[model samples]
Target: MNYFKQILRFAKPYRIYAILNIISNIFYALFGTLAMVSLFPMLNVLFGKTDKVKIKPEWNGLLKVREYSEAYLNYYVTQKADQGNDDVLIFMVALVISMFFLKNIFSYLAMYFITFLRNGVLKDIRNELYKKTVDLPLSFFSEKRKGDTIARISTDVLEIQHSFLSILELIVREPLMILFTICAMLLISVKLTVFVFIFIPISGFLISLIGKRLKKHSDKVQKEQGFFLSIVEETLGGLKVIKGFNAEKIFNRKFKESTSRFYNYSNTLLNRQNLASPTSEFLGITVIAILLWYGGQMVLVEKSLDPGLFIVYMGLAYNILTPAKAISKASYGVKRGNAAAERVLEILNTSSPLQDKPDAQEKRDFNTDITLENISFKYEDEYVLDDFSLRVPKGSAIALVGQSGSGKSTIANLVTRFYDVNKGSIKIDNTDIRDLTKESLRGLMGLVTQDSILFNDSIKNNLLIGDEHATEEEIIDALKVANAWEFVKDLPKGIETNIGDSGNKLSGGQKQRLSIARAVLKNPPIMILDEATSALDTESERLVQSALENMMKNRTSIVIAHRLSTIQNSDLIVVMQKGKIIEKGRHEELIAKNGAYQRLVTLQSFD
Candidate 1:
């Protein structure tokens, strides 16, 4: 119920539609009661128990509205009988038939109005969930599964729609009908209505006690749902690896375990939730049976009740049970939905770790050096960089050469602010990056990593992501500079040819080159190339290095290279080991000095 109140805020924007639905529900409930009450006249006429009526019937104000209604109905029947229609029983049957028709007509209208509110809320909720997902920081995904997130957005949210909307009739319309019917019953006989009131709360309490564990079980079921979805996503995404490793049996066992857990948890949740409907219904029938035994005695033996009026009261009492059972089922649904709502709200309420600073402004251009001032970083508990410092003067080239784990990539990540440093500052020009807007800081630089990052799009569209306004000529020229235009031109669709996922349609070197073309198209003042030519055949490496050299010209470049040959002609080379720089100089200078850089060069030369 608390979660429902929370969800209602989303309905605020569509209050007009909700109000319209409420109005229709009033009419729907009113007509529904009239339909049931209309059946009383049919029973009275059929059983030959209708009372003789007199004209000029009395009205005792609103307190006797029911008496006034009955008197008006008697007048209409007499008038019809006098007009030579003379079929009193037929007129009563027509009245009963009309009420049923009106009930169904207004019921449709009520549902139609509610549909607008229901779907409107659905669209708004999904849109908000998706927007929050995109705005969330990358760090938040570290401990989350993509499939589980997908499930939350798609399946779990849809479940909420079903649980909430399907029971909306019970919440608003049916309850109103029950209330009006109960009032009518009290008007007929307060004593029987008192019994009805006592029966309701006792049944509700007993039913709710049985459903006490519903939310706990539902939460467990939802969690297992996420776990099983994760396993399915993992299995499909890694099918190639699984087959290559011949671990099909192992994966099958793991999947079976996940589903087995899911099966048990779901059974528990369903079992508990299912009990609410039948248990409430049974209690309702028990009360009705007792009421029948008591009311029948009053009607037949005591002769204190009219047959027509007693029939209507019985109909109203039966109507109350329908709503009571529905509400009981809805209560269990709300509990289950609460667990789902919490899962969804968990995402909606998460604050992004990376956010625009209050004073953020877009920088139009880069005019000075990019500086790393004693930057140190640790991802979680493991320190990857310690007191590392470097400066790339504007329009100058500096390359990093080091063993693995020497923080070369860390430096690149820091310069781009993919992560903020734990200690010290990285500055673009003279302004500390922390003081600059994140978008403005990253906008000035372009990056090309060892693995090419490409989407499943045409080659032209992929390049155009760097500069959406780039012309075809600009794209072709960038591709030419990247040494990718030759292969692209030979394709049937040329730049329009699709690259498939992560550029899987292309060779590794070709994909890397397309990535270079994208960076070239961006034409940022600073470029970071992290081992750009490391994963290539000799011929491919030669072509890509040529493209790299061309792209590096006149730009502030930071290159992290594993192959000594790639950085031999670099403007400056720094050798690093164990999170610290051990040597720094020109390639020749470092070789002549016979230090760490010299050792690296000699070791790679033999290979």
Candidate 2:
């Protein structure tokens, strides 16, 4: 119920729809009860029990209002009976039909207005969930599955719609329908109504016992659904590897296992949910059976109740059963909804560790050098970069040459502020990167990673990500600078051609060149190339290296180099081993020293 209340806040914007639905449901409940109560007059007319009164009944005070209303209705019917019994019967039938007609019309109106409120909340919740997912830190996703996030946005939200949204209708319509029906029953006979109340608590207690563990089972089913979805996501992503290794059966078996558990959990959850309707119906029938016996004694033995009115009382009692069944079903739905809301709120309530300070200033341009002073950082407990420091002067290419796990990429991540340092500060000019808005700080730098990340969009559209307002001439110029225009011009649609998923339609070197072209279009003051040419063949690497050299011409660049031959002309080459710098000098000076950088050069030359 707490989780359900949290989700209800999303309904605030659609409160007008909710208010309209409530008004409609109120009328629907009023007319629905009146439709059944109208049976009392029709039964009296059918039984030839119409009263004959020549004089009008006087108005009574509120305490005797029910008796006065009956006296007035009897006098009115007696006047109508002067036409004929057949005409009076027709009139009574017309009254019942009109009551039912109005009831159904308002019922339709209630559903119509509720549709807007329900779907509006659904849309707003999904939109907010997506925005939160995007705003969360990259580190937050490290321990979570992508498909699990997808499940929260897709299936869990739908579950909330089906379950929690139904509560809105049930809250106003069902209870009011029951309340009106019960009031009419009390007007007929208070003793029988009180007798009906005793059994209601017993039945409600029994029905609630079935749903106590419903949320627990529902949570398992939702989690298993997320698990199987992850397996499918993983299989699609690694389809080529699976085929190359001939491990199709491994993934197939894993998928089947996940689905098998989902099957079991769903069966348990649905069977419990299915039990609610029938159990409530049987309990309601049992109550109805008891009422018939007790009310029969009042009419037959005590002579305290009228037969025609008892018949109307039975119809009103039957009306209560439908709404009672609905309420019981909705109770089960609420339990199921609680599980989904918890999963959804878990994402929405998560506060990102990388929030910008309220007073943080925007730093739009790079002036002096970028500085990392005594920075100690860790992904987990052990420090990946301990007391690491570096300075990059404007318009100079500083190359980092290191073994695989030597923190070269860590330095790149820190400079970009993807993760903040544990013990030190990274600054642009003199302002700490943390004190600058992340967007403005990132705006000054361009990143090209080991993998060429592009979307399944046109070459032009992918480049537009760098600068949305870039002109066609600027795009062509940027492409020419990155050496990508040569191949792009030869394509079927040139820059407008669609690149397949992650730009898989293009070759490795072509993709890297497009990446470089994107960076060139942005034309940031600082460019960080992390092993940009390492994944290409010899000919491809040569072309990409030329593009890299051209792009880094006057930009302040940090190059995390893999093939040492490419960085020979760099202004400064820093050699690192196990997160610490071992050598720093020009390519010629490092070669003269015969140190670690020279050893790395020798090793690459041997390769």
Best by TM-score: 2
Q: Per-residue alpha-carbon lDDT of model 1 for 80-176, expressed as tens digits?
A: 6566543877877788888878877777877887778778878888999999997776668878988788878877787777776666666788789
Tell me how candidate 2 scores on lDDT: 0.93
Q: Model 1, residue 232: displacement in angstroms?
A: 2.8
Candidate with the greatest lDDT versus the true structure: 2
Q: Please, what are the lDDT tens digits per residue for candidate 2 over residues 1-607?
A: 8999899999999999999999999999999999998988888877877677779998878778678767877887898888777777888899999999999999999999999999999999999999999988889889888888999999999999999999999999999999999999999999999999999999999999999999999999999888888888888888899999999999999999999999999999999999999999999999999999999999999999999889989999999999999999999999999999999999999988788999999888888998889998899988888888889999999999999988999999889888889998998998999998889988999999889999999999999989999999999999999999999999999999999998989999999999999999999999999999999999999999999999998899999999998899999999988888889999999999998988887788888
The TM-score obtained by model 2 is 0.98
Worst 10 residues of 2 by lDDT: 45-54
- Deviating ranges (above 4 Å) for candidate 2: none
For all predicted structures, in order, the TM-scores are 0.93, 0.98
Native-referenced Cα lDDT, model 1? 0.83
| lDDT for 552 (candidate 1) | 88
